[model samples]
Target: MEDALWAQLQNTGLEEHDDKDRIEAESDDEEVDVQEELSVPHEERLQGPQTGPKGVKADHEYHQQKKLVTESKARAEYNARLLAKAPMTTTYLQDEANKDREELLILQAEEEEEDDLKYYREKRLRELKNMSRQQRVFGTLTTITADEYADEIDEEMGDIPVLVHLFDESIPTCKLLDEHLRGLSNKYSLAKFIRVSALQLEFDLVESPAILVYKNGILIANLVRIIDEVSTRFDIDEIEDVLTRHGALSENDLYDLPTNYA
Candidate 1:
């Protein structure tokens, strides 16, 4: 009976050991399951592209990002290639100098164009005034024989310059001067021209051909028949110049001649 009791006690001990082993095995399985639930997946831990806040990778935004990156790279390459042609100096002054030079050339060109336009405008105005002066015409010469015509000469005095030739018809120089005076009368019709024989005036001729210039009712000059300031046979331009210088013709008369007529 003692043997039977010892055998029963051994059996009970074996059963308790078996139960403890089963419980430890089940606890190990539960610990493995808890570890799996707490840890993250390998894909979720990777440093991938930023999706939206809800973790969605949109197709349109991904394509747009790729296009922007490609365009940025292309622009950077193009700028680098262009800048290689003209490299910057240590101070970057060489690039700035070229830019300033280009700007100066553009400004100088604009100023030259403006100056040329102004010169043309002034030239055209002068040309028009000269044309008008040449188109004007004056009247005929008056031959005075008696003092009765002096009143008529006095009336016309101050308005125009009066050029008078006192002549002795017997002198050959006087006859030549009379013809030249008549020609001048037709040209300067604005001025009054007169011829008076000294014999008709009952005066003695100190000189055969005497010219008197009068302006504004006063005598300006008395002269002999001379041209070219020295010789008798002279150019018409010289005659015109002489008349203009002496106040018979105005300053505007000089501009009426062509440039080459001098």
Candidate 2:
């Protein structure tokens, strides 16, 4: 019985070894199938040598270097164009801006000057117009004439000329000269000339029997006593001779003085 049991044990061990061998062979086949399934074709996969951490880092750095070189070239071209355009663009814009400023200032100054001139001219014209309107004509000298002179004279004498009587007709020598005075008055007419009676005009004055010369309602001078009286008298004949010398007197012979001195 002992010998039979020992043989049976040996047979059992042999069976276990065979089963182990079969399991190992099946596992090897399955590993081969999995590797084949996971792998791509030789043409499709990257065919290269085996790589490590250092090789991979080097490949990435090469791509980065190429990208940096391309970007730097593009940036340099753009900066060059920008720098070239700077001087012309800035100078043109600045000149245009300054011209506009100058034009505006000139227009403003001209407007102010025109306004000032207009204001001054208007002020001066207004003052002159007012002064011209508020002036008087007659003066204080109009109050001194006597009653007879008032009756003989008109109020509006206004720039008219007059003649005068020099000698008294009461004297015989003056009476002889009265004919010559009448002849002189006839010779120069339109001289709104007159003769004063010597007795009437000789009051309140040192020289008597004199011819009073008048123009524009003011007494100019008098013709005093003289020898030749008619042709050679140095009289102040303002209405005739003096005004003729100055070219201001007109003599139209239609209006004549009455010979009341005769």
Candidate 3:
């Protein structure tokens, strides 16, 4: 009986031992599954390309990433090229605009300068022409003496027709009448206007300045040298009476005189 009991105990212990071994074996199997999941991807990378549509999709994804990277690089290069050209374009445009403005200003200034030069040239020409005309006219005068007109002076101015003489004080002939003709001009109303000079002919004489009338062709009277306030020397009415008696101072003999002394 003891031997049997000992054998039964041994059998029970063996069953428990077998259960522990089975449990240990199952734990080892789970550990081996986890290890295989972790290590398998490395094995597959070494094994090279996969199979079916899954392999194709993975390849497509890789190519898509490559295509995106290439497109990004090309865009960056194009942007850099545009940036480099921008400053040159702006500078060229600015320079061209400045040149156009400068040219326009220069053209306007030249036009104004040309106009001023033309005006000055024309004004100088006019002045020169006027000077030439005056010189030509003044060149034609002739000299005269008092003795040549002595008979005409006495006959016309002495007794019958009272005359008022207008002569240049500087001339020797005019100086001869200094003692004879004094204060006679203020007494005459219908008087002769005379100019006697060798240089200028502003009034009537072809050669001047000389004794002449204010009107160019009307010979109403001639300027002669007579001394004294002659109307008072002989009362103007008495002189008129004398003049009328001698066929002078007639109504038809009178003419218009120049009022402008200048």
TM-score of 3: 0.23
Model 3 Cα lDDT, one tens digit per residue, 36-133 = 64566754533343332347865676566667768999999999999999876667789999899999999999999999998987776666456444
lDDT of 1: 0.65
For candidate 1, write residues 189-253 as lDDT tens digits: 56777888777877666555666777766777656544425355654565556666666666332
Ranking by TM-score: 1, 2, 3
Model 2 gets an lDDT of 0.52
Which scores greater on TM-score, model 1 or model 2? Answer: 1
Ranking by lDDT: 1, 2, 3
**In model 1, which runs have C-alpha deviations exceeding 4 angstroms?**
1-138, 224-229, 232-239, 251-262
Highest-lDDT candidate = 1
lDDT of 2 by residue, 114-212 (tens): 999889877765654553344211111121223445343443255444544545556554454455445444554434444545555554323334555
lDDT of each: 0.65, 0.52, 0.46
90 Cα displacement, candidate 1 (Å): 79
Higher-lDDT candidate of 1 and 3: 1
